[model samples]
Target: MGLLVNDLSVHGQFADLGSFAEAIERLMVIRQISLRFGRTLHCHRSLAHARVTATMTMPQAIQALAFEKRRAFMLWLTQHGPFWEDSRKHGPDDWIECNGSIVTDSAVGEAAWCCLNGIKQSLVSLTPSSWEFSPVPVDWVSNTGDKKSTGVVNHWTPAAIEAALQAEPAPLISWSQLDALAIARCTRLTFAADAFAPLNGLPFVSGAAQRLLFVLETLNRFKSCFDVAGQRTPEGHEIYHDFFTGKKEEGGRGALFSDSSDEEKSKFRSEMTFQHPADNTMSLFCSWHGKVQTPQLRVHFSWPIRADEPVYVVYVGPKITKQ
Candidate 1:
């Protein structure tokens, strides 16, 4: 998860040393909470030199902090120092495509740029009045030089940080925690109990579980769209194309899907047929497959004729026979 500290909020916002110290404490707590959930706090490199009050820079403020608070703040800075430095390397233009507008060179604009490009966690701010730094829609300029409103960027004060972290989606499940039952339960995708047996014999490959989950999730989403619309929408096809070409990067892993070649399907008809999960007497030709190329993992499933019926995964393992 990505959390960008609004560095501009740190400068000259505090009323006194006491409030500045309190803000530091809040930041430390936020950092600890983020770490517990496997996230890191990032700030622009300029934060190190940011003024805590009109007269005191961050370093000076740190020195003035109470002993225990100073020690903890220093440690947090030390641990995340490199991340802050890295953030400095990229400018707002790097995110223009995603935001479709020019971000101001100011601190809040930098935070907005980060949020637009997948650093979507809340923008952490020092003072309660950091709301002032929240940019209005009018602040953004479109590529054609027309004013456009960027997506709502969430500005999180110290009080709201914990709740925001708790609301984030659950972490990805590991390969060791993955199984056919888990997949079915997590995705609500239906398949026979024996459909996943092939997975038991396949050697474990790095990122296999993640890749498999992506395929299942994509298939489940497509099923949902079909159920709602009775036909695939352009948006649905765009999603399919992204996964089909391994272009969607946010999901667990890259996947490519295709139908079996006619020659291969003809020769391996028996190998591709499996008992339909919805009906024991009926067998379906499970020729459509999603695959991970490096380790050659394949998941074959049937595309049901009826919109109401779910896709039935019939095989999961090595590639089926092909000439």
Candidate 2:
């Protein structure tokens, strides 16, 4: 449930690059869901090829679809084309009739593979050359468990997967492969409004603030332990962690959750570097922020911007630290 394989279940059916692109756009722009337009095409054609072509045109077609209907189309497409194809291959073209049953079966499998390949190619092409400062990036990074599909399909109900592996031509992937690829794409896209645009009225805050707020809210609801704080130096704001309760600075904002009740916090501490100071730290914690529903608060801090990091992340749990 918390891996990339889960994400691909949504996008693997796209027959070609076109539908794949449309699928991404639909999810990113108007809320990620199964779209309506894709379904009519899937139901009418009962095949991935036709579904793919129809999906490719969805961006424009969506303009005509009611905002509410878009999700229906996307969900229908997900439930129909890709799912069915992965479950089992279908009949072949007339030309293949001459070939023996075995050869024809091989042909169908080949077609399915090709369709999946097209989807992979399309997704890679659609990747933003670079991301601007946004809350959630479109693709998932390994740090956050978001994996891209490199033709490795790992999710085939255990029994089905076992069967596919035993089949001829040594299958390269399973249904689960699509899940990871899809999540990878999602992780890459940032969900935050483009810089200054918050859906409601407000300053829209800063990326750091938004991220810290998410962490605090999650811990509060779940009753998990965490520490967070920001410090101003002659250089800039340093938003480092104190791990366990340590000697407090003469003047400092204690970690978000630490209180007088807990005199000594754990000694273990760590730092999470972002792709950019502007990229913020929260995106690194949750694969995507907006996807989570909680409070609307942000953490403000001054830190050196690091672009080379490209979402660098580190984790340190409860551990004893010396002074």
| TM-score computed on alpha carbons, candidate 1 | 0.51
Number of the top-ranking candidate, with lDDT as the measure:
1
What Cα-based lDDT does every candidate model obtain?
Answer: 0.60, 0.27
Residue-level error in angstroms, candidate 1, position 55: 5.4
On the 0 to 100 scale, the lDDT of residue 67 in model 1 is 90
- lDDT tens string, model 2, 225-268? 22233323322222223211223231122233232222222222
Regions more than 4 Å wrong, model 2 = 1-213, 221-297, 300-323
lDDT by residue (1-323, candidate 1, tens digit) is 35667665675777777888777777777777777876667766566678778788888878768898787667656554535444342244432322334445544565544333223434666664444454433243333343323443444555466676687765544443456434655464676677667767566643455556666666766666553658777766765665454322322233357677798889999999988888889988888897754456678887642366677777777778744
Worst 10 residues of 2 by lDDT: 33-42
lDDT of 2 at 100: 23
